[model samples]
Target: MLYHLAKNLIMILFYPLFRIKVTGKHHIPKEGPVIICTNHTSNLDPPVVGITASRTIYFMAKEELFEGKFFGRLLRKVHAFPVKRGLADRNALRSGLKFLKDGETLGLFPEGTRSKDGKPGQALPGVGFFALRSQAEVVPCVIISDYKLFRRTKVVYGKPMDVESFRKNKASAKEMSEGIMEEIRNLYEIHKN
Candidate 1:
């Protein structure tokens, strides 16, 4: 629909300009309720990750981006929803869970914000809460880039991590978040070297 059309247009513009390289695309579940956990480096991360994957992704964008009427309308059309940063926004969480419950893909940047140094930061507990609540698989995605115009950028998808183990152990939200961040960091290291 509109999402794919916009994605196709952006890919046509971004692919040649940035020389984006996506790896491990097969790791994405062909169909299922899954969480796409990725490291945020720049504003381009969402679109890049969205286009690289075979399935459509509903991403949680910061609330500030939705302040403008026209831009916010555009974002909504492309499957982007507003999320309040720095606090637990229940509405946003509910929306994300609803998507998963409906067997749709939900994209999240566990770090909560883009890294200034291009490294993965500590994950917020919301990701863990969502995974545990929905009992969905979490796929670790690593986006490596310097955000330079017309430069090379790489997006790596890691194997999906199941929430079963954490649930079996009765792990807390913080513990699950830490474990998820550890997995993402490991994926980053593996691809870095």
Candidate 2:
């Protein structure tokens, strides 16, 4: 209820002003636990990805962004939970797992932070941990926008990548993360100019 209300309110407030286009939405899994992993580029990325998806996207935001009193509450109301940056925050991880156990979708940026340039950046291994622990399907997405305008924004929801088989590969944690990151880079390359 809160998520829908917040999304609707946000759409009413911003959609008219910005040029928005959302594609590849069909790739989103309709039911059960799923993680939508995306590339981070701008402050606009989370809401852009969240508002575009038909359902509420419970996304991870840096703990720093949740600092302001009013805005922070508003962001949380819309499902932007905070995780400490530069490392895995246990509380945030537990919260995420709990949400999955409850059958909710989580939107995460494996990169951990915004890309300095509006291009693909190295993704972190945190996603590997989520995949290992939650056993949720990872839905890949690349939100393409020219950084200046939201008008030409095209959030490409790529094919779902199953990390289950990869789990049994007996790779080290770092290897697993790099493997997931490799797939992410593939999608990034496949979609870019």
Best by TM-score: 1
For 1-193, candidate 1 gives per-residue lDDT tens digits of 8999999999898898888888999999988798999998898899998899889999999999999999999999999999999889999999999999999999998889889998899888988888889957789989888868888888899899867889999998778887888888888898875
Kindly list the per-residue Cα lDDT of model 2 for residues 90-193, writing each as its tens digit: 99999899988888899988777788887767767787778778867778888767656345566778777867777778665556566666766777687675
Clash pairs (backbone) in predicted model 2: 19-151
Q: Go through the candidates in order and give the C-alpha RMSD of each one to the true structure.
A: 1.1, 2.2
Sliding window of 10 residues with minimal summed lDDT for model 1: 184-193
Candidate 1 has an lDDT of 0.89
**Residue 45 C-alpha lDDT in model 2:** 81
Q: Give each model's whole-structure lDDT.
A: 0.89, 0.76
- Candidate 1 clash pair list: none
What's the lDDT of the predicted structure labeled candidate 2?
A: 0.76
Best by lDDT: 1
Question: For every model shown, what is its TM-score relative to the native structure?
Answer: 0.96, 0.88
Q: What is the lDDT of residue 37 in candidate 1?
A: 90
